[model samples]
Target: MSDFATNARLATAALRDLFDPTPLQRNDHLSAQYDAEIWLKREDLAPVRSYKIRGAVNAMRKVRATNPAQQVFVCASAGNHAQGVAYACRHFGVQGTIFMPVTTPQQKIEKTRVFGGDSVDIVLTGDYFDQTLAAAQNFCTDQNAHFLSPFDDPDVIEGQASVAVEMLEQLGRAPDLVVLPVGGGGLASGVTAYMRAESPKTQFRFVEPVGGASLTAALAHDGPTTISRVNSFVDGAAVARLGVCTYDFLKWVDPAHVLLAPEDRICVTMLEMLNVEGIVLEPAGALSVDVLPELSDQIRGKAVVCVTSGGNFDFERLPEVKERAQRYSGLKKYFILRMPQRPGALREFLMMLGPDDDIARFEYLKKSARNFGSVLIGIETKSADNFRQLFDNMGKAGFSFRDITADEALAEFLV
Candidate 1:
């Protein structure tokens, strides 16, 4: 075996003492849909519901073996990584201090505390992840505690490679193609490295949220590059910049092989997996599967593996997810209408709707002059094409309206 494969095997063996290898199940639903042999590496089933625990456990193991005197571990995370580090700290019986952004959801904060138990101290600092990360690093230096990175560390990357080891063993063969989600690139880098060494025939496709395409940005620049802004909709994978160490291993990846899944489109995938397959995936967790449709032709009749990286979803976000899905599917739209003040004008406008069209929302803004009044209207239809017909009818009927469904600024204020 190659050196990387050997190391990954060792890491996989060590992890068995902590948790069993997560399932590598053939998903009949997705397979039939895509006409491919779709297997899912259920990293969501890991102890901390993410592949992150693998890295955290391995990093901790290596650290304590060399220095038994190391009693403290520290990290900064807004979600899964913090929980993974906390769980590892408790398992190792080491004291841990986790720094999280003040804007972090209470559900995540509570879960981190639960995993770490009395072994951890939760510190809510900074409004954003960068600030919290800086605080964690400075505090670790001041306290002489070992700071565990979410990604970017060599030991952490080695730990992540264990996923590939497990996948090969569970599947009894290397998959023809492996799809991975990209965030800080720890999991993707490790899996790619291990597979390159152990199963050179396997091809890889990387997925990232469109609003946070850090890996694509890195590939475009020939190195790691920071984005000016990132949409946090896919919180698990919305990394502003790819990690340096991760990019080192992934720098040669072809930019074309990296697919960008839109955040809104990802929400539709999340809801579909939940409703159709009864599989609940967080936005990042759904990344690999979200891109499956794009690869349908290429992967037809081939054995494919999709790593469902995490399942740390909060049920409270379901409404938001559904809303995004509706918007993306074009089944829902918002519009501002200029209604004539004539007594029968409202009735005339209502007559333009198709039988399948339903008014989801309607409100009238009064006008002092009485010639016309502003109306905020929302409509849901059975078919997306119905909107074109509805707009056409409205135009011929002399009703003036402005479609605000795609207007980000207007939607934020009114919708």
Candidate 2:
């Protein structure tokens, strides 16, 4: 076995001291829908509810073994990584200091604290992750504490390879295709490296949130590249820049093999997995499964494994998820309509609605004229084509309207 594979095996054995292997169960629902054998590497069932614990435990174990006196570890994370570090600290009886953004959800903060218990200290600083990371690094230097990176270290990558090791053992053979979600590229890089060494015939595909295509941008430029703007909707995988160490391993990936799943479209996938399959997935966790439809023709009748990276979704975000799914599915729309001020004008407009159309919102924007007023209206329909028919009927009736649902700038403020 290669040195990396040997180390990964050792790490997998070491992980048994914490939690057993996560399940590699075939998902019948996804398999039937996609017309292929679908298996989910359920990292969501890990001790920290994510595969991040593998990296944290592996890195910390190596550091402590080398320097037995090194009892302090530090890291910066807003979600999974923090909990992973906390859990590892408690397991190894090491002191940990975790820095997180002030805006991080209370559920994650509480979970991290619960995992670490008295072994870790939680510090809330900065509004963005970069600021928090900088603070943690500087503090580590000043205090002489070992800093644990989320995905940028070799030890961490080796630890992450344990996931693939477990997959191969559980499946008893290499899958035809392995689909993984990419953020800083730790999991994808590590898993790909392990698979390439052990099962060279396996094909790999990487998925990332479209709004935060750090891996795609890095591959396109042949190196790590930073995006000026990133949507944090997929907070777990919304990295501004790909990690340098992780990129080194993933640099050989074909750009075409990287799939960018849209943030709103991911919401639809999350909802589908939850409602239809009874699986709750965070936006990042659903990345691999979300892109399966795009790969339908290529993967038909093939054995495919999708890494469900994490399930740390907050129930509070359900409403937003539903809104984004509705918008993406064309079940919801926002428009500004010029309303007639005369009597029975409202009744006349209401009569134009199709049987499945329902008005969700109506608000007066401004007075357009002495006999007319501008109104903002939100509508939900059973089908996307319903909007076209409604617009046509409105046009024939001389009702002027502007669809604002697709207007990003205006929608941000109004919708």
TM-score of 2: 0.98
> Which residue pairs overlap in candidate 1's backbone?
none
Q: Write the per-residue lDDT of candidate 2 for residues 96-200, one digit (tens) a residue.
A: 999999999999999999999999999999999999999999999999999999999999999999999999999999899999999999999889999999999
Q: Model 1, range 1-415, lDDT digits (tens) per residue? A: 8887787888889998889999999999999999999999999999889999999989999999999999999999999999999999999999999999999999999999999999999999999889999999999999999999888988899999999999999999989999999999999999999999889999999999999999999999988999998999999999999999999989989999999999989999999999998888999999999999999999999999999999999999999899889989999999999999989999999999999999988988667646999999999998999999999999999899999999999999988
State residue 250's C-alpha deviation in candidate 1, in Å.
Answer: 0.5
Candidate 2 has its poorest 10 consecutive residues by lDDT at 363-372
lDDT of 2: 0.95
Q: Identify the leading candidate in terms of TM-score.
A: 2
Report how far off residue 240 is in candidate 2 (Å).
Answer: 0.8
Alpha-carbon RMSD to native, per candidate: 1.1, 1.0
